[model samples]
Target: MARDPFATADLEIVGQVTTASNVTLVCGADGVRVVYKPVRGERPLWDFPDGTLAGREVASYLVSDALGWGLIPETILRDGPVGPGMVQRWIEQVRQPVGRPELVDLCPVGEIPEGFREVLRALDGGGRPVSLIHADDPRLRRMAVLDVLLNNADRKGGHALDGADGRVYGVDHGICLHTEPKLRTVLWGWAGEPVEDELLSDITLFVKALPGELGDRLAELITDTEIDALETRGRALLDNPVLPLPQGTRPIPWPAF
Candidate 1:
């Protein structure tokens, strides 16, 4: 069974890698995998305080839970051998032919794949109601919208998970929360298309409800200014005006779905 962080010689140190952030791995513990962060750090972006990424990771999972989205990695912040770090669900990927990793913010308009489009359709929420989807879904237009409002700069392709039953997941929300538009993702191939009225209303309802359920969490992590801006955007989307959509972010990235 999966267990909490514990001091154990069983945690075999694995090789280091510099893909997203420098991460250390510990393998071969019954149903356990450990990811470690180094104290001697890299050049920090001044906006976010040092050692804040862990908190962001927690917050992202919480938000994903709130939305009832299964696309986020299962994570917990626990006392580790070093200090405090996050323990996420261990993923084992067999050799399967998938598309190349692509960033949603930099996705070319014409390069979106069929699976990406299918996930967007799944994420559309249709004409029924405004509900939450998992943050892990790669074709997460709503998550992307939230990412933009929160200024989540780390919404990478690999970070967006492709689940076991062919669902997408998302992770690594360290750089979220900002007051700027920050809507530069590669998931919007439908920029010229009209925003559907049903989905627009759903965003309206979701934003209106945020103050009740999401407000408390948002208050702690982000500034009041940002919360208000997100509300404003939701309302604007509901109104369906000819406003400038988030540029440079296609709704689907290649190999994303």
Candidate 2:
């Protein structure tokens, strides 16, 4: 079998992402920074199938690319040091702790700020009130739209980043593309707002190309039923073309960061 560009690259581990379920390594490959998530290192999750999160990560990049939104960084499924897995461009951004001082900027709740959206609220360890807030930047808004289409189940405040290129990028998509409607996120700021004409046009294109183009590629990574669900979600987004109202008992992820 022919190898992808990343398949045989020399990878040196730079660091480890401890919070991730899988052993995620920040690696330097041919002088380029990339994150490598090996399939063999993945710990099983109850909701998701075993050893398939890497595929889901790659699938997310494919969807973002197909949509022409560039919401996700460049990602490829290839061999790593341990085994075949997912490798994605490492986004460089100033790191901020999840809660505490940056919490208001990254995620806010109650008496929302002028330019932020209150996605959800929660109580801290001491039963203090906290709200999840996301910036109202248009780039983030587009990411929100992408999350909806992906049926993203984990869109924490920390997953969205302000990249060095001045673009908003979303990470940690291993739980996406589910057959069910699982659109949890910290991006409810645009709920009830009309989707911009430009974004709507992109969504239209994605809907048209999904089944024949993107669908074939995603089938290799996820289930056929997931592909079907993806199309269903895309069509639903097109039909409404608006930020949706939150549904179900839990519309936001825990520790929203």
User: What is candidate 1's lDDT per residue for 1-257, written digit by digit as tens?
Assistant: 64443434244445444554545444433446645443233336677653456655655666556545454667555544455555566554333456443323222334454334312332222453222112323346555544543456555456654555555556666666555555444344344345545445555556767788677876665567756766776566656633244455553333332
lDDT of model number 1: 0.50
Best by TM-score: 2
TM-score, candidate number 1:
0.61
Candidate 1 wrongly placed segments (more than 4 Å): 1-15, 22-30, 34-43, 49-51, 92-95, 98-146, 192-205, 241-257
Which candidate achieves the best lDDT against the true structure?
2
lDDT of 2 by residue, 1-257 (tens): 85544546688888999987678999888777899999888788788773399999999999999888898999988877777888999898855555433322432335666667666677666777777676778988888889988899999878987887777889999999888788898788789998898988887888788778678888889998888888888788878888888989988887676
Scored against the true structure, residue 107 in model 1 reaches a CA lDDT of 27
Separately for all candidates shown, the number of backbone clashes (residues 3 or more apart, or on different chains) is: 20, 4
